[model samples]
Target: MIRRAMVLAAGRGTRLAPLTDTTPKPLLPVAGRPLLEHILEFLHAGGIREVVINLHHLGHAIEERLGDGRRFGLRIQYSWEDPILDTGGGIKRAEPLLGGEPFVVVNGDSLLELHLEDVVAFHRARGALATMVVRPDPEAARYGLIELDAEDRVRRVVGLPPGVEGTFRGFMFPGLHVFEPDIFGWMEPDAAYSVIRTTYVKLLAAGMSVYGFLTPARWVNIDTPRALAAADLTLRTAPFRF
Candidate 1:
C-alpha cells in the first residue's frame, strides 16, 4: 500500500492575488477552517500516515500552523525550496523523504472527496507507471485535456502527438496522482517544471503505462476568488463524509 505522499504547497498562487499576499494559498479558509487542514484530514482519512509538504511563499506560517501534523494524525515533513520549484521539481526535491516506493502526490490548492484506497488499488491493479485521478469536466479543454482510451489508459495529454482519431473521452486532472518510484527516471533533477506538461507528456510519447482513473467524487480547485467562494458553498451545503 502507498503510505507516503507529497503535497505541492509552494506555489505563489498569483491568481488569488491580495488574499494570497498575506496568506499562502493552502492556508486560505474554505469553510470554517484553513484549506490545508481539510486536505490533511482527507489524507489522514485516506490512510496516508506520512506527508511531505514543499514550502515557499510565506511558508513559515504554514509550518507554524501545521507543525509535526500530530493533531492531524500524520507525521509531516517539509521541503524548503529556495526559488519555489513547480510540481515535478517539488516531488523530485522531496524524493529523499518519500523513500523508494510508490507514493501519492496531491495539489495543495484543491479539495477532493475521494476514497484514496480505491485509487491506489486501481493503480496497482493496472501496473501503471502512474495513475492520475481524472474527472469529466465540460471545461476540460480550458484545463488542458487528458484523453483516455477505452481501457482508461492515457493516450494523450495536453494534445501531445500520437493523437487518437477514434472515440475517446477527455478528462481533467483533479490534482491527485499515484506514481511509482521509477517515475523519477523521466524527470530532471532540481529543475522547475510541471509534471503534466513535462513528465506525463514524455511518458505518453515513450509509450509508457500512464493511466487515468475516472472518479465520481466531488472536487473543487480553489485558485481564484470565484473558485474559493464556490468551494465554501459546496462544503457548507454538502460536506464530504470521509
Candidate 2:
C-alpha cells in the first residue's frame, strides 16, 4: 500500500492575484475552510498517513496554518524551498521524505474526487512506472495534450514521441499522479523544472511505462477568482461523496 504522498503547494499563483497577494493559494478558503485543509483531509481519507508539502511564496503562512498536520489525522512535513522549485524540482527536493515506495502526488490548488485505492490498483496492475489520473475534456489540447493508446498507455505528453499515427484518445491531467521512486533518476536535484514538460515527456519518449487512469470524478482547478468561487459553490451544493 502507498502510505506516503506529496502535495505541491509552492507555486506563486500569479493568476489569482490581489487575493493571493496576501494569502497563499493553498490557504485560500473554499467552502468555509482553507483549501489546503480540504486537500489534507482528502489525502487522509484516501489512506495516506504521511504527507510532505513543498512550500514557497508566503510559505511561512502555510507552515503556521497547517503546523504538523496532527490535527488532520496525518503526519505532515514541509520541504522548504528558498527559491521556489517548480513541480519537478519540488518533488525532487522532497525525495528523502517520500521513501522507497511508489507514492502519490497531488496539486494543492485543485479539488478532485477520486478513490486513491482505485488509482493505486490501476497503477500496480499495469506495473507502470507512473500513473496519471486523466479525464476527457474537449479543451484538453489547450491545456496541453496527453495522448493515450487503447491500452491506456501514455503515447505522448505535450506532443512528444512525434510522428506516431493512431486512433488514440487525448485527455487532460488533473494534477494527480502515482509515481515510482525511480522517476527521480531522470531529474537533476535543485533545478527548477516542470514534471509534465520535462520528466513525463522524456519518459514517454523513451517508451517508459507511463499510463493514464481515466476518471469520471468531479474536478476543479482553483487558479482564478471565478474558479475559486465556483469550487466553493459546487462543494456547498454537492459535497464529495468520497
Candidate 3:
C-alpha cells in the first residue's frame, strides 16, 4: 500500500562539480532526459501516484522542468531546501507530504532498475522500520557496505569496521529504500544527517528491523563521469526498461 514516495535530490553534487556548477545532478541528462525524470517515471509505472522531490543546488531549474509533475502523470511536489539539509533532514522536511505510512526514497543521482512493487511488499512483510536495496559485490570497500544476517536482516554497515573476514557478505547500498513514517522519530529536525552515516547504522545498533533486499540482477549507480558513461551504455541493453 505504499503509494507515496520521496526522491532525495537536495545534495550539492560536489563530486560531479563543474557540470553540476550549472545544472543540478538530478536534472543532469541521461539518455537525453533528466535522471530524476526517469526515476519519476519508474515510480509512476510502479503504481506510486504521489512524489515529493527535495531540491537544493540549482533546484529552481528542476522545479521549472518538472513542475507539478503534470507531464509525467504524477502529482509532484517540491521540498525546496534553502540551506540544503542533508538526507535525513530533507526527508524530515517532506514528512508531511509523505503522509502516515511507509514511503519509497530513491537517490536522484543513482540509476537502478528496481522492482518497486516487490520491494514495497517485502518491506511490509518484514515489518522493517526501513528497508535498503543492496547488491552483492567485492567493491563493497569502495562504496559503503551492508552485512545481512542469516534471515536477510541487515546486521551491520561494513565501512571501516573493526575487523571482518572475506568479502563473503560483499554488498553495497544502491541508494534506494522503503521507510515507515515513524522512522523519523530517530531523526533530529534541526540538524542535517546522512542516512548511511547516521540512521542506517543507528538502526542496526538499536536492533531495529532494518532489512536488505538483494537484487538478483545487475544495477548501476552513476556518480563520476566514467560511471555515468557506463550506466548509459548499460541502460541501453538492460532487459527491463524502468
Deviation (Å) of 183 in candidate 2:
1.0
The TM-score obtained by model 3 is 0.92
lDDT of each: 0.90, 0.91, 0.81
Candidate 1 vs. true structure, TM-score: 0.97
Angstrom error of the Cα, residue 43, model 3: value is 0.8
TM-score of each: 0.97, 0.97, 0.92
The parts of candidate 2 lying over 4 Å away from their true place are: none
Worst 10 residues of 1 by lDDT: 159-168
List residue ranges in candidate 1 displaced over 4 A.
162-166
Tens digits of per-residue lDDT for model 3, 1-242:
67888999887888887888999888877777778888888898788889999988888998999999888889999998878889988888887788687799989988567668888899889988999988877787678778876678877776533343333365888788999888888877767878777877677667788889888556665588887777767766663465
Tens-digit per-residue lDDT, 22-51, candidate 2:
999999999898888888888888889999
Name the runs in model 3 displaced over 4 angstroms: 159-168, 237-240
